[model samples]
Target: MDAKVMNQILEIAFEKRVSDVHFEVDNPPFFRGRGQLIRSKLPKLKPEDTEFIAKTILEANKRQLDPSLREQDASYSLPNGGRFRVSIFRQKGVIGIVMRVIPPHIGSFEELNLPVVLSEIVKAPNGLILVTGPTGNGKSTTLASMLRYLNENYSYNIITIEDPIEFLFTSSKSCIIQREVGIDTEGFGAALKAALRMDPDVIMVGEMRDPETIDACIKAAETGHLVFSTLHTQSASSTINRLIGNFPPEVQEVMRQRLADMLVAIVSLRLVKDKSGENIIPVVEVMRSTTTIQACIRDGRLDEIEKHIENGVAQYGMQTLDQHLIQLCQQKIIAVDEAKRITRSMDLERKLMFTS
Candidate 1:
């Protein structure tokens, strides 16, 4: 398809509020909505169609797809102001694209159906707050909601370092300075280092993608800035291990200590279809770093972390994934089978039975 046709397809996707759109050679466009990938009945795309589509996206960002380049990350804004996070890649030796729709406006915690505990979690004056999940599971949306909350209620300086930034925010009660990784700065590490000197009360790094970025995030938190970032992990315990595991074995202990000191909370999310089978809802596992939990991390007792998360539910707004999945099942928000499918624990059925 040509640029006009591609834009028309995007306009249709935007109107329908699809989560993502896929364009690939030899296949009709596919749209993902409510956790389902539905193929459009339009004609299948040819190689030139996808190449032209990719070229349109790259040119919009003032970029060109080099012959040797295999993939790219970019953002696009529609004529109506809708935005998308675009991932352009090569598949089967032909250009393929996936565009994730970014809602024109950021939703509030309540509006997004996030747990009320997030309001309490974001109150921490300084420390690292991580929102972890597999890709496409609302981590960015959750972070954006938290920042929107801070922007409306608190008068502070907030700096965001992003790769092709999504969800534009206007200055409200807070002064927000958003720096894109390639356009406004060299990278996350450099931007984060500069952020510390910019007098920011809160800093949001789009993703902790590397050792330097991760280290910078922790240092920012340790120095009393509220930092937010994401990881492609499923749980709090795993998130900790992933961070520490990134370092050499000799220095893992030091990394663990740093994380224990600066980590404020871990909000893990999984989206599942609601009971109605038409909409998707998030099952959240929130682990606030209490003294006991901090000790678990510092002492390398990763196995005990989930138990403490389960125990801290009532007092500290903490909950394990299974616990929240059980709650969702109990409340009839999601089917029992869906809960069972999402939780990795062997005893999920047993726990649901006993808890119910």
Candidate 2:
């Protein structure tokens, strides 16, 4: 397959710092930058153009475009060190593609404007740590930052099982091994299970997508390996509930008990525009496994988790999303209107403004 046209499109995306590039039949190419989609001035793509792009991308990655399958996900790296997570699918019986840019360098926690508490989360010796958020919300980037921290500071065998392996980590003080899901191993669950035998001191699972993967991650943590993973939940409480809810009703109680014992912390992130509206900043909700938090999880008092996070900000280094938003607003890192849109709690906003 000829990839010249696709390469040109990707090079443009790289230069513009575009977060995503979209190609669809009958629609002009578009770039999603700073949370907005901007259409290219170029004319709409023809069906053949999209088909050629799709085939070229798949061929470049040594993947096949199976018409029988409605969708496919892959990742490709450019010769100039740019990488993208590509999703190609059939829409209206025509090919369409979405490519997300992955930065070549992994930013530090401070560089990413992540909370300082994240440093503590990455330093833990062993337990399950989760970064939870919806897709395109910087969840993978946050986890990558943590792994990079460990790589730079400690000497351990770190194994990461990713679908397409987003960040490429160079060995600093650690022996880092990255395995792609379909390339290096069979899948997340199988790779995780094999990682246990690989003598990994730290393990990063790209995502906990199913019960088997979740159970394997918990077991790996229980067996004295520091495990980090991501989930598609909006809040700390929701992340916990989602994990336990993945199991059958009969096994949920058991899972909860295990989670209470083996869980370390949960960090939920949302990226909103900074004060200039030109960049995104993360508003985070952190929940550490204190004695009280452990009890709440074991006893199924999930509703109280948020309150604990609110009250424990000063003592436990836990912060609710509202608390973080308030801090950002007070520091002029984000405008009040933007903060209000994110928090979506006028009463809480008033309390934050009036308190102190």
Candidate 3:
């Protein structure tokens, strides 16, 4: 491995506050900062140089490291509080490495500019609260923030299971036990099943990777352990479907009822650059379970679920993505033009602007 080049690249990555660094053949190395991409200081990496850089990352994982050259996915901690989830692979005979910089410190709700209601969610002693979004949409940051909130305010045992374990947290009011996939445990399903026996008061599953893990999370919540998880779905209803759809058709109904019963809330978010083109703002859609909503979830009326979320804002803590986007625009935290683009309901964005 070209140790010098790799060291220089890490230096530049940390200096820029970049959240990720991507290297591939024939392209200039670039990194992500504050949700935006910035060019890397290192010149375009040659095929040979990229291979060396990729190998440097794999060597850090002794057990997972392969001398015969195989794709690997793991997290690494850099000097000065930088952490990354590195995935090394070969694409079209060219070495490629994608490293996502873990935020050095987890932020709180106020620090992340999330809704105050989130604090209420974290305060729950038991139930399932999901914060979900498409990849790179700041779901981890939000989840970290909520977990940090609990870390600071409550005196309880909080456990988290992450694939690569991004965003490290320090003990505060809560004692945290973080287990990473492949490192601390076998996999998501096994870790979740084990967490039940760990006697945890709160459990955070990094992402619901499969049916078994989802089932265990629901069971954990049902058994009086507050649960938090993520799914790669855009909205609340879609998140519900993603969970139920993971199971086979024969038992889907049973799982749906289980999900409906233990589910407490869901936060779906997207991060958009602000008006100044400086930083990103989080646009979220929230669904807090109510009698009517829980009833719809049980009866298979998922299609009509939006009405309750969009129309019952005052009655429940629910807020549509469009609602949050409009508010961001109104506050001038994000540009109206960009906000309109990412918003799910462009029609609603237009309508709300006029009424507000």
Instruction: Point to the candidate with the largest TM-score.
Output: 1
> In candidate 3, what are the lDDT values of residues 224-249, reduced to their tens digit?
99999999999998888888888899
Q: Weakest 10 consecutive residues, lDDT, candidate 1? A: 60-69
Q: Which regions in candidate 2 have their CA more than 4 angstroms from the true location?
A: 344-346
Q: How many clashing pairs per prediction, in order?
A: 0, 0, 0
Per-residue CA lDDT of candidate 2, range 58-146, in tens?
A: 78767777778588787877888899998888988888999999987799999999988888888888999999988999998999999
* Candidate 1: tens digits of C-alpha lDDT, residues 1-356: 67778899999999999999999888999999888899999999999998988888888887887888698888988888889999999987999999999998799888889989999999899999999999999999999999999999999899999987988999999999998876789899999999999999999999999888999999999999999999999999999999998889999999999999999999999999988999888889999999999999999999999999889978988888898888888898899888888888989889988998
Q: For each candidate, C-alpha RMSD in Å?
A: 1.1, 1.4, 1.9
Candidate 2 residue 140 C-alpha distance from true site, Å: 0.8
Clashing residue pairs in candidate 1 (N, C-alpha, C atoms within 3 angstroms): none
Pairs that collide, model 3: none
lDDT of 2 at 119: 87
**lDDT for residue 288 in candidate 1, whole number 0-100:** 93
